[model samples]
Target: MTSDAPAAADKRPRKADGDRLSKLARHKHIISQLTAAPTLRASELAAVLGVSGETIRRDLMELQEQKLINRTYGGASRPFALEPALTDRKAIMIAEREAMAAVIADLILPNEVLMLGAGATTFHIARRLASRAHDITVITHDYAIAAALAVNPSIRVLCCPGRYHPNEGYVFGTQTIANINSYEANRAIVSATGISARGANDADDEAGAIYGAMAKRAAEAILVADHSKFDQRALTVFAHWTDIDRLVTDRQPEGALATALRAAGTEIIVAQL
Candidate 1:
């Protein structure tokens, strides 16, 4: 179906995400230039990106599957709750994911305990976290996180090991839960599969078990999502809004999101993109 040559090239060029930003930078540029910014018609994105509208639609579909952005009648828009896979959304979206991750990383304290989820965004957050010299303990289901933080005895980067999930980039199972329960982290820097009006957040598989357990074990739950996870539901619900003490998302959430979370008494912390 695909060529190994291009697939192999994907890894070579993406050392630290150098070329990953190429496609996403275009997407962000278009979004920034457009007006009446609610619904982005697929045709417009295609013209801007110099691709066919169908190609843009395909991109939108990829983003929708990950719940990073919402698809409307004609196009997609940034929703308040989403965990998109920029890796699959073309190289450009990976840049956007990394940008989003940088914003999410602000929630980390110098020496706080962090719980990271598995995905494109959290992977970038892991990279940023690696540079900081904090007595930090990163609890994660992501195999990447452990490997990234390995050899760094200064920051206790612990992985919640289980059945490895290739897609979400983590391992999940009872062992993951057990490791998560063992840690009493001060804060959890995590992501979700999706969100809904009723305040249910879900993820793929029972993989959310580690996410839920970490949130419950932590003193604070700092949900790091872009403005895309809103109004969607995944296979499993990690927790509800009441448990989400502080939410760190890109840009100030508006529209129904402002109404929805306020009604639930959840504190919204927006990062300037």
Candidate 2:
């Protein structure tokens, strides 16, 4: 009697058996797209990948479960919680931040008082200022920024007295706000976690309050944010577009965000990287 077992070749793994591997690849592609653009609609993703809507939805679910993306109403976006620590942020968008910092540095004229906010991008601006040999006064709440600029004898670094946040390496409190109110600066260069039609937002309340105080005390408030910050929303709206005189970014704003920025009369300077 002949055995009923199938042939060895027929029992071997086939292309259909690689569904798990294919799904993993698809998941990575979805994450990459989300990283490039803060938000991505499911329909657009499905069409672009030539996959069914149901498959896209399933992939999004898996990605969300893995904490690689945040599921929104009709799409997905990068997770928005607290802003990353300064050191962690220093490694992100380095090229864009450097270009933006250079642009901001050029905007600074010698002898003008400047207020710098606490953020990785602003820290880059502080480093840029360190390279300058001009005499200027700098007031900031970020300890890292103050330390970075301390090497410049021509620049005076003033630290705001407040409760220190060790994790962020910054000081922010009622005292910090009052200190910012006591002095006026020619320009305030600030960065935020997100920038949308709503406003320039921060992930922390204290930091957001400090940004508002700084912007309020400056003659001109310029916001420095990279392309990744667009279309994203954070916990706190620190300053409205009306409060900002200019925005220096790596890329041009698009859609509603672009329209809002134009309507607000905020001069947009796209840094050449």
Question: What is candidate 1's lDDT per residue for 1-273, written digit by digit as tens?
Answer: 766664433221122455443556655554453322545787766664566787677777877776566788888775543344635632443555566666656556778877777766567677767765467777788777677766466788776668876765678888888888887888776777665545546546575666677779889876766666655555667777777887766657665556767887888865555
TM-score of each prediction: 0.63, 0.76
Backbone N/Cα/C clashes per model: 9, 0
* Residue pairs in candidate 1 whose N, alpha carbon or C atoms collide under 3 angstroms: 23-92, 24-92, 79-227, 81-228, 81-229, 81-230, 82-228, 82-229, 195-232
lDDT of each: 0.66, 0.88
| Weakest ten-residue segment in model 1 by summed lDDT | 6-15
* Least well predicted 10-residue stretch by lDDT in candidate 2: 10-19
Error of 1 at 59 (Å): 23
Q: Per-residue lDDT for 1-273 in model 2, tens only?
A: 888987565321224554333677778778777655778999987776667899989999988888788999888997764577778899989999999999988888989999999999998999998996379999999999999999999999999999999889999999999999999999999999999887799999899999999999999999999998887778899999999999999999997789889899999999999
Stretches of candidate 2 exceeding 4 Å from the true structure: 1-63, 68-82
Using lDDT as the measure, which candidate wins? 2
